[model samples]
Target chain A: MSKKSVPVVNIADRLAGFSELWSQKTVAVLNDYEVKLAKLRGEFVWHSHEDTDELFLVLSGRLTIQLRDGDVVLAPGELFVVPRGVEHCPLADEETAILLFEPAGTMNTGDAGGPLTKAAELVS
Target chain B: MSKKSVPVVNIADRLAGFSELWSQKTVAVLNDYEVKLAKLRGEFVWHSHEDTDELFLVLSGRLTIQLRDGDVVLAPGELFVVPRGVEHCPLADEETAILLFEPAGTMNTGDAGGPLTKAAELVS
Candidate 1:
């Protein structure tokens, strides 16, 4: 495979370009790479992907990944990876911003039904 | 493969646990997953891995990934990936902290022989 270059993106630069909450906007793509931004509030739907793990990195505010066993709270500069086939939901008290990295074709809301299942195109 | 649980580690907790600089310490492992910490200063040796690409996420201060063409500067809460077979090095003005995610056998200084090519065992 030929070497494909992935552009260097700054979170502050991307955050400055958009402001709406809970809307994940793509910043760059590297082969199967998918990076997105979303401002989350209240609770998200519990969902799980049958394939591929999901990486969640908290950009600002607090984020909690609720699982069947327990919940992990992520503060600013913290990260958590929700493994494949694990049922999880994310919640935030106020407006919380986050960056998500996953393989292409991974859903934001997993298999659960939710109003926030965004089918956003990858933005270059 | 049975589901192997990997402990969720907080960066602040890990940073507080260790004070020595430039030493990359392992916190958790998920199958082949390896997470490390390093306090960088000055310029690093330019090298490249023949295998997996490397992920760099800046924790504090500034980090510059020197490429053959140009360098990418990463501030706090920013991330960049150095593709496999691409020569690169990390430089810091003062003492800067960073978190790295790569496969188990990925080298910190790549193939370049350096004093910081630590063979330290992964801490549990």
Candidate 2:
């Protein structure tokens, strides 16, 4: 029933460990999904996940998910899901802490990949 | 690109809408997984989801996930995943608010269906 010590993912504690903007750190794994935390600043590359929907929950500051049709604004304790195949660009006026729930191998920049496109690094 | 108006799910606002203990309400859905919020008080029936893992993130108060070998206690801003097929019982000494993430249609009392067994109600 047990493997290692009690596995508790402290969101705040994990966020405090890193400061790199736009970089996501995997905090926990639930089945095939990965729970990730990232600090966002300014605007990100416009991208669209072709395989799965991406969930973004703002932990601190504010986030605006810019879509082709509209912009979805989220504050602390708020979340939004960018539907799969729908192009979206995430931006934040201030440094924003966010929780991302997606498949394990999801890339940061979907479809369009360039400098901001990178893999999520495991934190703990 | 657009479905309706803004689809932002505010966790605190949704939590305030319900007060039924051990009952979960779906606030948002991403892909096939449903994000649910539940208020817990006292002990829940020991159960296990044989097919998928269940993730529990404590939003308020404390929660002790009693496992077969050990107990995983979580506070506000903390999360833990009970692996698939692992029997566990969740209990809270005080009123607890928790966010649950699992596949849609997953039962409340998993393998064991009793009085606590029910379906998650969708909220807004």
Candidate 2 docking classification: medium
Chain B TM-score per candidate, please.
Answer: 0.86, 0.96
- Candidates in order: C-alpha RMSD to true structure: 5.2, 2.3
Tens digits of per-residue lDDT for model 1, B47-66: 88877677787888998888
Badly placed stretches (over 4 Å) of model 1 are: A1-6, A28-33, A113-115, B1-6, B28-32, B113-115, B119-121
Worst 10 residues of 2 chain A by lDDT: A1-10
lDDT of 2 by residue, A40-64 (tens): 9999999999999999999999998
In the predicted model 1, the residue pairs found to clash are: A22-A39
Candidate 2, residues B21-109, lDDT tens digits: the string is 99989988889999999999999999999999999999999999999988898999999999999999999999999999999999999
